[model samples]
Target: MRFSREDLARVRLSAAPDPLWEVALSITKLYRPNVTEPYAEWAAWTRNVDDLRVRSAARVLGSLIPSRGYFPDFLTPADGSPSLEEGIDAVLRTPRRKLRANLGRLGRLPGWAQGLADGDPAALGSLGTAMRTYHDGMLKPHWERIRRRLEADRATTGAAMLTGGAEQVLSGLGPAVRWRDPVLEVDYPVDREVHLAGRGLLLVPSLFCHGTPVSLADDDLPPVLVYPIAPGRDWMRASAPERQLEALLGRTRSAVLRAITYGGTTSQIARRLRVSPASVSEHVGVLRGSGLLASRRQGRGVVHSLTGLGSSLVAGDDAPWPAVNSAQPEWCRPTPPPS
Candidate 1:
């Protein structure tokens, strides 16, 4: 596939991240094993694990997302800062006529998705619930690391474009893309060309997209190119809080602490640990009281992250730490254990 740029001024770069897109693309790993190496450990760790809720969700969403071919563009919007609930609302609001047209174009959809065309409220609600369930189970645990990689990619891409030009940044996107003067070529199963006639383009970096960059099937929607970002070996290290913490706090609480290394809310922590939100809240309260965790209110929920004391304790305990303020010592940054 090729993207035609009438002029250098016609090209644009964006680094907005969305959770729904991650859910849509990451589900592909469940069915496509060949490209799962980078995520193989995570995939294996999550497979057959308890959490029947996420499993049911996977089946429902799996049908919506085939191994190939076009799915609904509305499912993965390019909103700058997207949340699961917001994405669900968008999906529910999709016009019946547009939903049927998109689904019919894909030949046959899953029963749940088909029910959506018939305006089944249950199916719509179920799909939304399933998506949240899946996100909580599969993606929330690794979100901190994922977010860091995406931020790094944005910084690098932005710097490249500033130091050089759009041509340099486009050529450096990944091995799957090429810049040939006025057109940007990408390796796609389907042959097509998108003319960015002053509309420019939205460059989205994804952790789940393996090789080919994905674009919307509809030309009318804002053009977006979702490409993959490689995670370093350090980022691939498994999450294991210090054995001492486990002994001190018990296994479940210890694992919860490790999952919140980069900080998360009660629902996110609960989803990651596969425990009840109330349980997580209780433990978080205990940890906060102990000065091992700090809570900040964001929107309707509180975001829990490690305080400096908490960071020092986790570092001493030998758990993975997220990035901290630059003023802090080197011990605060996440580093792989010495071999």
Candidate 2:
């Protein structure tokens, strides 16, 4: 049981957890250092657990081999003991030419990248037509983005948990991490356990966002979270409010939201809603002028969407919002019978 009766009682106290939950967890694990609690390892380890493996990161790498990088005649163990670092390096350090050559081998027009393509390809390939097309085409740029993200991922406590042998090869370049010292301080119903070295300090900025008190740590880079618990106290607390909020955002249907949600820029939103381009533009303009929506142009045709207040109303929330959705557009929407 990761949670207790008393801990569970305080779960709903947060109004709006400022930091992300992963940031919260990473902070807790690094500062508090929980050793006992029967299931700690499983709890932390599962974050990167290869379960969702629609295509493992390696698979993503393999896909771009022919076009982006050179595959060394290297064979490494897939199991836990071999060290995750070696595995990643194998993918990362493979000679670029080899990767490009290998890519040339497979479905040159491969519908399903040999499980090694990183990010989106059709989007990346437009940038070039090189020997290491996918790698140069897709993976390399994504890796740069990924590298920066990994740095942020390693910032809070990414150092200690060496995924493979990454730390061994790049000593000093390793992540900054430490065992939690006693006398931990924390925010309750916490999305993450805050772990600090020593303090009656009463103030340590949240690791992820220095400006805000830490909420939770889900680690954006390699996508791992840390949990800090002193030898005991294995209790579960609902994560920071933002996690739920993000999840809600993630689940939100953008197209449906456009049609049902209200705001501005009918042309921009209309393109998205798949309704008559003009009709979408007209309705969005109405919503905006009527105070049912708010919008800002993000370059691609002054985009539109519902206002905060508007979304709540459409979401069935009574936060005093104007009706954003008009009669659903006729093109894709179900037709109503004549009165």
Candidate 3:
């Protein structure tokens, strides 16, 4: 394939941005909140475990998210009293190895895997806390900020969807964002930063303890922080339907269907997707065009509803949609392979 300078520019500019935090966000939002589906499923799996399973599951889930890879850190013996060193060794050696490798930061990992390969499992309880700290203290705060900004942007975007001023649309909203000098160490190359700067997304490294009753604690694992570079550019896309189904179904559309399964509208879908109403309208257009949705003009504007096809689309059916937009830089959808 031939590449344009602009295309290459965007490629060089690419880095996993803030929403990548969605992996952790999914876990926490599911399990941490009142029970969610995944959490309920996970809990169901753990319910039968004796104490040993409990600790092992905790250790494994701890290592899985930041690393976003699954390894069976839990599944060892909880013999009367497990050794802290043994637990640490099990996780440090097995799950931790998998985690580092996946993040592509394994070289930076402590050989503590081999060292703790023989350490205490009890220490692993603290290990979850440590890993959580790296993820939560580092990535989480930034995530909330980005999510909040994205959500707010969506509201204003929705309000202006009927109107046509990208400038006035944005201007009415004001600058709408402010980010202080990063509170974390970023590990990306300077060129990547340059790229991100242009794209309006920022990725930083979150290392060490900050904002507390006292001083910094020396014993904490530093987490890699990934967040929006342009904070505002989080809304850079009019419609990022890079994937085929996404182009057709739309983020807002998918959100709407999900809500429909639960029940939702353009306003509600916008609220859920953290996108603007106009963005929602754009998605609704795609869905309606694809015959996956039906819309009617009500008092002031359009009200959209899922068609029978939309119902199937939401039920995990993807074959009906054309794979036309896959090559469009602005569209995307990654439907999982059927089992």
Candidate 4:
């Protein structure tokens, strides 16, 4: 809660985005919606869309290593954004002494983590396997969109800091965080003050970080502040459609079209709908061929958005399509929904 002058002076901004943290936080999101209300909607979405494996892992981990209580920092080390594989490897390599100490701080090591106290290889392997499976089921599907959103936040934060100052940017972070003079007050689950010492601070933007900025369990560890970024426009507009578009495109494609407006990759869309990527890709390919959707490469995946024709179609503009003389033209061209 209070930062010394040295800590304030050493404050630094870095976007070391880590998938490991996302994995833990997302599991937390599904596990504890009552505490983190911002994630209530997301929890519903995850329940509807996340695979069974992810849900199962979340339940198990949530019961054991609570999202609110102290957990091992090595589970999610804050050293520059490590890949999921690398982070898991690090967890597997956690020193027995360090693991024991961290778990002791939390009272007892959960059954799953007890192996680490004895340096059991099976325990480490099992943990790694579960984490990897959870990542593939939950985070990987939406990582492209997540990465883009975090990158946008990074740019925005950098701009704010440049134009105003560190204090200004910190003050503007979110409602849950406050920039009091000589102290950064965060609405944590419990009372805690982190004296940053001279270690400075690492600011990590998180999508699943709902209500408050989260700091690591151990104050001795490198100081990092994980805060939430406002959801993108696509996140809020999943289910709006004109009746005419629904009839013309059928229910599934129409839904896909609406989802494309949010601009995400194939995996992201598939995950959103709880369907297979292959199925989504088939539809996306068809839509792309029909000039209803456009896509551009982003990293290893493609981000799809509505084209002019597609946008018009969804917006109830039959003007884009000339009238067909046939009695039945795409489900009678039903009356378009009110704009």
Candidate 5:
């Protein structure tokens, strides 16, 4: 893809994962045969889900999104709304001409889909219902894990951009993408070029986008690149180790540590734990001093993330704890009384 100076200047990462994009991409993953590690367990679980509503919803989405091929761009609108309801509303509100043009590209749609292509109201309503049902059933259960993983990715990308500019962010988007000055080359199924004529690009990190990065097939639409994230081994499973840590640290302190699985500011962490900012700050100071967490200034507030020792502790690994010292304090002792 070709990028101009304005395009480069306007480049920004999505603050959070796009729900519609994820729902569309995840549908593609669900239909794939012999899915591999990272996705294998999820695919298995989804296949075994016995809800008739979910199954019906999946069928509706599956009919639109092929396992490997072009899906309608209207399905994944680029309105940048974080709310799924708003996104779906945007989808349902797609102009008839645009819908026909996008769906027509697929060639030879089924009779039922013709109604959707012709912008029939009943068809649009059914589509919206299917999307909501599928998302609530499949994605909602794992939304927290998904949000944490994407937020962590955004944090890493943001740090790179802060340190070295947009070029650094582009260069580091994994091996599937290559940054060669003016043009960014991607490993797409079809050989295509997207020239962002000063509109810039939206970089979205997705949990369901596997292998090569995906973008809208239509160049005329808003330019977006949805890439995959490498989630931790415990990403899907509930962290039982947090409960164990509660034995070492008190309940509130343990809750604070668990809240920082991905990373957050004091205020963000406080909101997650539903505690006061002062309480979070005191707990964070202790965690930071004990060498279980690290904090760095970002703009007005500091972002805190787990240190190596803290990560192992949270994951319940058998790695030996760091020796006690003034520089590297121990966190194994009882939680200090909050000031």
Candidate 6:
């Protein structure tokens, strides 16, 4: 993708994961489970879910999103609302002309889908209901892990930005993307180029988008690049806190570490773990002192986040400590926790 000076300045990473994007991308993964090795456990569990409503909903979505090839762009709006309900509302409110144009790309449509293409109110309502049901069944159970992984990716991106700015953030977006000054080349299934003509780009990290990064087929729409994220080693397991980590760090500290996987202020983590802010502060100090955490001021509060060491430890990796950089950027250097 080619970017102008204004585009570069306007590039922004999503603060949170896009629910509709995940919902749409996840449907693709479900059909091609063999290609998604990282999601094997999730695939197996999803297949065995005995909910009839979920199965019915999946069938409805499956017809729209093929295992490969074009799915309608209306499913994932560029300005995806923060909540799933709002996102679904956005999908349902797609202009009739836009819906026809997007769904028309699919060529021949099924009898039921014809209603959807025609902007029938009942069909639109059904689509909204199915999306809500499918999300609750498949994605909701794994949403926390998804959110945490995205947060970790954002933290890494934040560090990259601190070190080198937007260019660094683009370059560090994994091997699938190459940052070559004005143009960012991506490994896409099709030969295409997006000219961000001062409109900028929204870089969204997704849990379900595997292999190559995805962009909307229509260049006229808002520019969004949804790329795959690396699911940590412990992503597919049950929701129990790691006993081994707890044993090593003791219960409160371990809980504190896990809570900060999504990064939070003192009161935020304290509220999450149901502990007093003072106790959380004490533990945060120890963790930061040991190089397992990093704290930086954000407005009135200090936001605590896991360092690479803390992340590796939390993920249960036995990797050696990362080498310390002698010339770390000022922002990359750790800040003292807020007084």
For model 3, how does the per-residue alpha-carbon lDDT over 223-279 read when each residue is reduced to its tens digit?
122222223212212222224445655544565554433224566556544567787
RMSD of each: 11.3, 20.6, 19.2, 12.6, 12.6, 12.5
lDDT by residue for model 5 over 211-259, one digit each (tens)? 8899988898889998888874445665556457888889788778867
Which residue runs does candidate 6 get wrong by more than 4 Å? 232-234, 239-260, 264-339
Scored by Cα lDDT, where does model 3 land? 0.35
Tens-place lDDT per residue, model 1, 30-146, is 555343467665665556345768777777777777656676776776443245566678877777777787677766565557788876888778878988998888888777557
What do the candidate models score in CA lDDT, each in turn? 0.70, 0.30, 0.35, 0.68, 0.80, 0.79
Estimate the lDDT of model 4. Answer: 0.68
Residue 214 miss distance in model 2 (angstroms): 24
Misplaced by over 4 Å in model 5 are: 232-234, 242-339
lDDT for model 5, please: 0.80
Where is model 2 more than 4 Å wrong at Cα? 1-99, 102-279, 289-291, 295-305, 316-339
lDDT of 1 at 150: 70
The Cα error of candidate 5 at residue 88, in Å, is: 1.1
Kindly list the per-residue Cα lDDT of model 4 for residues 1-339, writing each as its tens digit. Answer: 567777766666653357777887776655542533444444444554436666555554554456455556777876644456768888888888877776666664456667766779987787777888877876665565476567568778888878887778779988888899878888887888787767878888888766677788778788888888886434422233445667878867776886676477887777555468898899999899999999999988789998999877766321222222322222212222121
The stretch of ten residues in a row with the least summed lDDT in candidate 4 is: 330-339
Poorest 10 consecutive residues of model 5 by lDDT? 328-337
Q: Against the true structure, what is each candidate's TM-score? A: 0.69, 0.21, 0.24, 0.64, 0.75, 0.75
